[model samples]
Target: MLMNILSIGSQGGWTVAIVGYSIVFLALVCLVIVFMNLPKLLQLNLRKKLVKEGKPCAEVEDLNIEGNVNAAIAMALHMHFNQLHDEESNIITIKKVTKNYSPWSSKIYGVMNQPR
Candidate 1:
């Protein structure tokens, strides 16, 4: 049965190829359509949720330039103070490490010796 199927002549091969390609292209087109509309659908759902929550559908604009200026000034002051500070004398140091490996310490060699 496998040999019979594999022995499909030139015309049968072309027919199978065309059908397979058509199915793949049709699936791709369907996916493209769904993806293209996905963002719009999500936005509509968001708008609906916002409306249900009594929030405005329109986006709010940030109008406070003074707040931004105050934040910038605060950051600058913090950086200036940090730069003027001195480092502490206390420090941490790694002293020593020792490693000892023995054949009896590991079971990997025993497992490797087992027959598959």
Candidate 2:
């Protein structure tokens, strides 16, 4: 009975495959739709929760200063720290040293007991 039901050449097998694929496709479509609207849904729920708790749901605004004002601030900061700052100095320097590769350098090899 099981062999008859699972036979690939039979109509039952094709029907089962079609039904399985359709259900998976539908589930994937539903997941895609849910994910697409998830952010807005979360925001709405958050706003509702905030209102219920008697808290403000105001959106935060970004600071948009003028370019001239930014330049002035930068100049003021540079002038204030002029004495402490270095005009021509290396921030970081890396010196490479050549070393022969050895298995003993690894932690696994180091864990082995060695005779004195």
Candidate 3:
């Protein structure tokens, strides 16, 4: 029976894993659904507010920002973010280090003696 297989799976930690996975999956699914409809939900609220203020539905429903304006906004954001120019005083420093007796630099202990 299908119940036998269900019992076997339930006895292991598979049940907990499956339950947690399903919970997360369902939560993400719910989030996706809400996000997908979020714009519509906001628009509905805006429409209601507009109607309450005696504005017609047709104009309110088809409201859109112009493409050129949107592009300009996008370009401005891009320029603002991608401003890679940093003010710098062109200066460089070089130093040399020498240690005369470091154990790491000494070669005396590096050789292994052969066994006869």
User: What TM-score would every model get versus the actual structure?
Assistant: 0.43, 0.39, 0.48
Please report the candidate that would top lDDT against the real structure: 3
TM-score of 3: 0.48
lDDT string, candidate 2, 12-115, tens digits: 77788899999999999999999989866867887788789887777411333556998999999988899575565756888999989888686765646675
Candidate 3: tens digits of C-alpha lDDT, residues 1-116: 98776777447677788899999999999999998898788788889988999989788657767669989999999998777666567898788977788887676656573445
For model 1, residues 1-116, the per-residue Cα lDDT tens digits are 97777677864786788899999999999999999898668678877887899988774223224558989989999998998766676898898877689888787778568776
Task: Return the top candidate by TM-score.
Answer: 3
Q: Considering lDDT, which of the candidate structures 2 and 3 is the better prediction for this target?
A: 3
lDDT of 2 at 25: 100
Task: Please report how far candidate 1 places residue 49 from its true position, in Å.
Answer: 0.3
- Which segments of model 1 are wrong by more than 4 Å? 1-10, 60-116
Ranked by lDDT, top first? 3, 1, 2
Stretch of 10 with least lDDT, candidate 1: 58-67
Segments of candidate 2 deviating more than 4 angstroms: 1-8, 53-56, 60-116
lDDT of 1 at 86: 69
RMSD of 3: 5.7
**Candidate 1 vs candidate 2, lDDT winner:** 1
List per-prediction Cα lDDT, in the order shown: 0.78, 0.77, 0.82
